[model samples]
Target: MCRRFRELAAHPTVLSRAAAAAVALRAGVWSDAAHRFLRRCAAAGNLHACYFLGMVRFYCLGSRASGVALLARAAAGGHAAALYALAVVRFNGSGGGKADKDPHAGVALCARAAWLGHVPALRELGHCLQDGNGARRDAAAGRHLLLHAAARELAAVSSARRRGRAGEDDDGAAASRFMVEWWALTSAEKPATAAGEGGSCGAGEEDAEELRLCSHARCGRRETRRHEFRRCSVCGSANYCSRACQALDWKRAHRGQCGAARWLAAGNAY
Candidate 1:
């Protein structure tokens, strides 16, 4: 390998290169010394190089670019991982400007990413669809997409677990597992509006304020239109009005939703 590759290995944030290095090591692409060379190629910003580099930084190597830029670059270049990463960032408010904090914007971004062939994005897009976020509430399409996302999540989770080793630090695998479980649960949940089916419909234009959102199945009350409820554990319906209202009415209804609701919340049951 050339000296440049070796020098690149020492760079603080050469994630794309590091990813190439790891892949080369794993696939016998070349000797270890050449790994840095691959990283350099990626750092150079070639399209394919950027895509692979973005993936490596995300699924493996860490970097300094706030994670959002990496996803953006990859998504712009049509890399699936970049699209998925971008969705996660947008949803979690970790990147892609402040729009990540807006569910409506997040939904749009997720849909865009999904359309570009990202699994997590696909799943999240399903949620947006079911919830009428920047799109009409399409239950049928939501369910279908969620099912696909669920299956993919499950497979990905299994693959991640398989990659774990006794002495290995498996952050990547663990992340996959988390995604798998989340998507799995989400895939089981119901459509976003199931529980509060009639609550927001002409609940009035201004008087009706949506408020008090909760996750992990805790009970709560509604007050303002903040965010959509996650989902009923038993049913796919999303009941949001108040914690008191949730507990008072949902214990029984959730039983019906339990099978699908969790997954729907994760945006996988789409």
Candidate 2:
């Protein structure tokens, strides 16, 4: 099946717009040829092409209006990523000021994208449901969806590893990258008052060291109960909400700093 797809992909002109966009994407967006292909396909009203080109325009080139128009067009056609991208914009009020934020619309768009099997959308929708940010609070349903999303993420990573493309430019890798970057942005924006000195939630000064956030910077979830999170086997310092978060943290930052001596010196001895 992979060989057949490669054979079909070789004929870019005959490929569907999405396939063509994928080829162009693999060619690297900085390549003039890839850029031209994306532009031409986007001009031809190809939804996937519009999505890629619009993201480049909005994020890389800073062409907000044109990029948003294209993204909106693709989203209107039920492009999952486009819908999710627009949802992020709405949630952040990227179109205007904080007052312009439309969390309800963002939640609605995320729900649509989640229905289409966009993993990030599913995860974001779950968070929204849990917090009642836009939708009515449903902690049980939200937890179920979050667990489902985590399962899908693990499966995606496992599939990528089986294909010998674990770190390649695949959807799973892309989603992980998005999560890392998104968390960085949100962490910077979060108020200092939200977390205690040790990144613990609802902690008094005396119990500050008793509970802590997941050690993964991209997953700053605080432990809801004492000893709820698992500590790293190697260092016994870093905590993680799930195996997926642990893997991501290891890849992103923990690999270099994960040493028993180092953690012990930092007063994380356990």
Candidate 3:
């Protein structure tokens, strides 16, 4: 009865006499009901509501694309969190591909969110600095930000763990992981795996089979107008710097190449 009454008051044509029309959601609410409420409100074109649902989707509760697309739309419509999320979506190619990952726009949106003291945005700014993601890779600046994020995470965790804290949040796992990832990055004695070359070795290497080892034979530049060539295609079945190179390379290795190409082409999913 009260829900319907509040809804009617918030209607556009209604006088909106009530001072409190916005419904308050308590923590005990089940997931299905919350999804239903968000879905209804989002479908009604409520920008803020869509942003909320987008966060739910982004944090693994729903499909990756759906969350990002909705967040991009909401950010375009001026939702603040959505604006921050748009930056992330752009960075990850989730909303679209590299062409749509507008780094300039992402930086602007991130700055706006940072101005509002948004915690996630602060962490993101650190990430941008560390990765040179449309910005300079200033390790010092990134460390400062990761430290700030660590402090905020600790404070929130302390508050949440206090007795009678109402269980309104469960940020412990998220905070711990953030601290670990950030501290590892900030430390001068970083983990060895961070060195790209170190990741390429070992008998059980993850990329062992898929990666084609460069023979470096002749070690010549393989472009047509350059030192000269035999540039292997996807399966090493053909080497063609040009159609002309194709004939030369074919005479040298074509029969074997064709034999392998025939057997391999059928399952080249990678």
* Best-performing candidate as measured by TM-score: 2
Question: TM-scores of all models?
Answer: 0.41, 0.59, 0.44
Steric collisions counted per model: 43, 0, 0
For candidate 1, write residues 20-128 as lDDT tens digits. Answer: 2243223213234544554555555533445443433432333425234545765676666455545444444431234444556666666776776566567667766
Please give the lDDT score at residue 135 for candidate 3: 78
Best prediction by lDDT = 2
Across 19-45, the per-residue lDDT of candidate 3 in tens digits comes to 111312322332576667656666666
Worst 10 residues of 3 by lDDT: 217-226
Where model 1 places Cα greater than 4 Å from the true spot, the runs are 1-42, 46-66, 95-100, 151-270
- Of 2 and 3, the candidate ranking higher by lDDT: 2
Considering lDDT, which of the candidate structures 1 and 3 is the better prediction for this target? 3
Q: lDDT by residue for model 2 over 150-226, one digit each (tens)?
A: 79878877888888874335332343343344334435534664564332112222243454556877443444335
- Which pairs of residues have clashing backbones in candidate 3? none
